[model samples]
Every structure is written in structure tokens, then in C-alpha cells.
Target: MEESQEEIKRGLKDVAACETRISHVDPKGQLYYAGYNTDVLVGRVSFAEAVYLTWFDNLPSQKELSDFESSIISEMNLPEAVIKRLKSYSNSNHPMDILQSEIPYLGMHDPDLGDNSDSANRKKAIRIVAKVPTIIANLNRIRNNEPLIPPDDKLDFASNFLYMFLGKYPDELERETINKYMYLHLDHGLAASTFVARSTVSTQSDIYSGITSALGSLKGKFHGGANERVRGMLNEIKNIEDIEAYIQGRLDVKKRIMGFGHRIYQADDPRTKHLRELCENLCRRANKLDLYEKSKEIEFVVLNKKNIRPNVDFYAATILDALGIPVTFSTAFFASGRVAGWIAHIIEELNQRIIMRPTSRYTGKYGREFISIDKR
Candidate 1:
């Protein structure tokens, strides 16, 4: 049967599949998490407090934040078996693939693996958010044949992840940059990865399974890995003078200018404004302002030619590069922050108690008589 085009919602664009209290991207081009504007929350709140707000629907009090932060750091240690497994993998493996595969393996060791109670799920969420940074940092170290650095409990969430990754204490500037990055990435309402997570756990599957599914989804080029591509784009343009010609050439060929535009935001990605400034400051301090300038040129060219604005990933590529993170780990950095939001969506989906089972429209012919294979 042929259905009208109006009946089809490709990509489910603007489709409200379900309700969420965790976050929102409004038509007015602002992002909110639990009624707080993300712009307001990014610099002021610690990433831990932001995580707390996403999961619990409000910001934590001082004592609550302290306890929550401690709980996260305490769980950052990877099991010995997991470390050995990470070592066994080929260094050629992508970080996101390694992270995704290890999550289900980690699930096998969870004491409350079978429990889907609110309390149990919350605990699982903590373990996931905490361990993800450890997994990514260690994977990088293993690939480079360097000793892994353990998480520093004295440092807060963002600070500790930087410490583990860089093998040193981050200065206040670095700490502030990472906290803002993580907070900006903490959640977006029903993002592709978050939706995959919710759909997985909606079947009452384990939280680890839900998270694993989410990691795979986040690895997609159109989603989390766009920053890596943006970085690659930056490398392709060798000089500041070549940005326009390079962008125009790519556009003339109908190639996507990575890190530009968004599906949800018509004006500009609200997250881009903060990241743009952050990238500039980090690059300025690192004496790598050239990278920031090139990024701005690309943004300006794309905006002038296509009328499309830069999304969060555009400036994030420069910021991550300024922080000395390899392009390979870019999406893993995304997972490190987004796993919190995925868990929040998972917990909320569990409460819905309905499996996500959207049906597809079939356009093939029907009621035709079948012929036996021998008849032909």
C-alpha cells in the first residue's frame, strides 16, 4: 500500500517520540537542562553538580555535591581483568569501539546486574559515568605503551579525568575549560545516542547494555565523531589564507562542511557560543591562536556561503586540540560526558515501562500470488 508523504516522518525530525524532563532544545534556539538554561549552568556549576541535576532533576546542595563527586571518583578504577582485556586489543582499534565493547564486559561484573530498581539503576549509572573516563584514558595510555594514571579522588570529576588523561594536575584554566566542555555535553534532549540508550533499557535490558548501545550510536560521523572530522578538516587546510578556497572547493563538490549547522537549531547551536570563546582562550594560552583563527575563518566562510552556523562540534575540535588530546580520542571525550545523559534517559525510560516499538510504513506490493520455485 502506498502511503502519503505526509504520513512519513523521515529521521523523525521534530517528532516528539516521548516526554523528557532531563533536557530541552527549544525552538527559540536555547538549551535547558531541568528548567535551568545551559548557558547559565555551564560556567557556574561543576560537571558533577550538572550530572546530579540531570539524574535527580535539580542541582545538588554542597554536601550532596561532595558526596556525589566522591562516589564518582571512588568508582573510577577499572577491574584488573578489564585492563588485561584492553591490553589484548590491537592498538589500531578505534577508541569508541573499545569503549563500547568494554561497557557490556563491565556489566558482567556488576553486583546488581539483574536489578532494575530505581536505586540499583542509579548505582549502575554512577559506575558507568565514573568508569568511562578511566576506560578512555587507559586505552590511550595502553596504545601508547605508557603507564596508566589512577584517578585522583581529591580532584573533582572534570579535573580528575584531565589528570588521568594528561598524567598531571590540570591548571585552573585547563580545569575550567574541561568543566565547561563536559557540562555543555552533559545532555541534550533525546539526542541520537540518548534515544538509543532509552530504547535499549525500555526493553528492561541491563543498564550496561543500554550504555553500550548508546556508545555505538555516538560513534557515528553525523553525531559525536564530527569533532574528529572537524579536526581533520582543520589539518587539511594548511594555511589561514587557504580556508575560503578549501571551503568553496568542498562546497562546489557538494561535500559537507563538517561541524556546521544542526538539525534542531535554526539560528545557531547555543552550545557553540560558549565553546567558541573557550577555544579562543585555550588556544591563546597555549600559543596556538592560529588554530582558533583558522576555525573562525572556516565558520565565517561557511556562514557567508551557506548561511549555516557552526554547531558545538566546530569550536570543540579546536578546544580539544588545544588541550593536546589526539583527534582519535575526540569522540571518546564526547562519550565521557554524554554517558551521564544516556543513563538519565535510560532511568527515565525504565519508568515509562513501555518498550519503544515504532512501526515503519511499508510501500511494497501485497496480495500477490506466489509461484513455486519449480514453476519458473
Candidate 2:
């Protein structure tokens, strides 16, 4: 008897994507890059340094960190042409829509995109990482009808981004909060959006193409949409008295609560603990602990009844709210941090040079003759 061809499984959840000297996760679902735990790194390192560590597999020295910071801050201003193109979009368009359009447009201006060599590709990766903050901040400004500000050399990358986006330098507490937010979002283990980025670049597509694909996937409601939904949930609750009833009503209708439950984390999202601590501190300092209290109440109710815990989106919304970012721009802020991870994954895929094409099991009949128009 002839043996059937070995059936290769598509979307192999059990299979490992890469075996390398790169990052890994602990049994507890916590992530590490190049032997450093993310929790330790977020506390000890700046957002830019963490990003560099992820891509380069080591923490940068003082001079290298300065130069990398300088390069990233230098590219924080979008070209006028890019801004002009963004203005052409209707005000009704979501900022993600604008991002999806602008990321691919980077290819038109970046000459390094044409060079597929490893060194050139790495440079291109840095360019993508550097410029995406500007693109995302510019989109926020355009949406608000505010003028864009060029990056200030004196400010660190995270600080300059906040300054440019908000027209002023953030206070020490505000700056630290924003840095923590960026650090927490720097990477997640092979999320769908990151996978999309990897898959696109695996085909030898340029960094711009890979990022554009990732942005498209991130724009979906199941992904980056949680931040926006969390704000909506907060708005619906309005007062302390309404929290329980509001949640109970939604639960009664079998509605899935936003900002709780993650695809990868069964018990709790590891990112949540860090963000929650930062937000709680910020809220306490601002005398807005009531908001955080309300959030905790909601958390208790959800966990007691539904066994769900708050994900990154839950505390992220609270932190951004405390930072005075508008609800509309919350997801844009998410895009800011995720762009770093997207670029890193894109570079990794380009280095490996595997086309990520997968086949679907054929469901249609194979042999069918087409009828002629005359017969029909």
C-alpha cells in the first residue's frame, strides 16, 4: 500500500517559529530579549534603549545610545509632502487609515529600501523605527487641526514625541508615564499584527510594505481597537454608581467586555501588571485615584463572575486618560509603540528570507469544464 503524502498542517500553533539567539518567553508568559527580562528592562532602561536591544540583541553603550537617539529624533519630522498627502484624506478617515496609506509611501522617499543587503536592510529598519513616531504624531495633529512641530534635539525620543504631539514638554511624571507605556508595548510574542509584518517581509518585500501590512492588521477591532473600546466603556459608566449595573447589563447581553482577556494570556497579561502599577501611581499623584478605584471595581466584578482579568488595554486607557490624551488618539498612541516591534519583526523576517506563503485545503471540485456562452 502506498503511504499518503505527509499532511502538513497550516497555522501550526504547536510549531516554533524560530530557533535562534534572539528573544524567548518564560513559562509564566513573560517576555525577554537577549537574556534580559522585559520587566527589569522596562524599569531600568529607556524606551529607545529597549527598542535597540530588541533589534540588535544587546543594550547599546552611552555613545551608541546617544547616536541612536539622535538618529531617531532627527527623523521625527515628517516631510512636508507626506503631511500634504495626509491632509488630502477626509476628516472622517480614521488615523489608522492614514497610517496604512503613509507607511507604504516611505518607500518612495527612502533610497535604502531599494537595497536588500543585510547592512542596508538594517539601516532601513532603523529608518522605519525612527520615522514611524513622526507619522503617527502627524496623523494625530492632522486629525486635531493642529500644526506639526519639528523634533527638538535636546529632548529624548519619547519626550520629543510627547512635546511634538502636544505642543509642550511633558512634566517629569508625565514623561515617565509615557515612557513606561512605550516600554510595555515594545513587543509581544508573535501577535497577529506582528505576524502580518513578518509574513509580508518574509516575501522579500521592503520594510514599508511589511509595516503597511501590519498596520492594516492592527487596525482591526480585535487587535488595536481595544484602547478605543475601553474609553467607550469608561464613558458609558459616567459615575461610580453606574459601574456595576453597566457591567452587569453588558454581561447579561452576552457582550464581551473590552480591555479584558487576551488571546495569549490565559490568567493575566504580563504587560498589565507593570502598566497598572504606573497608572496607579500617576492616578494617586493626580488625586484621580477614584478613576483607578472604579477600574479596580470593574476588574473585581469581571474576575469574580467571568474569570477575566484586565489586559494592557485596560490600564493603558487609564494612563492615557491621566496623561490628558484625547480618547480619539488613544489607539494612535498604541500604534506609536507597536511600530518599533513591527520594524524589528520585519528585519528578522528579511534576514531569514523565507517566503511566508501558506496553502489552503482545496474545497472545490477539481475537474469541471466551462460551458460556452452560446450554450448558456
Best by lDDT: 1
| Alpha-carbon RMSD, each predicted model | 1.5, 2.6
Worst 10 residues of 2 by lDDT: 18-27
TM-score of 1: 0.97
Per-residue lDDT tens digits for candidate 1, residues 192-299, read: 988889889889888999999998998888899899999999999999999989999999999998898788888878999999999999999999999999999999
Runs with alpha carbons beyond 4 Å of true place in candidate 1: 1-6, 368-376
What are the TM-scores, per candidate, against the unseen true structure?
Answer: 0.97, 0.92
Task: Give lDDT tens digits, candidate 2, residues 1-376.
Answer: 3334555665565456644444554545577766787867777888898888888888999999999988788766666788888878887777777777887787688888788888887777777777777876776777778888888898788887788778888888878887879988777767778888888878888888888888888866677878888888887887878887888899999998888876656567778888888889989988889888888888888898889888879999988888778786777788888888777777777778678776655555655889999998
lDDT of each: 0.91, 0.79
Clashing pairs in 1: none
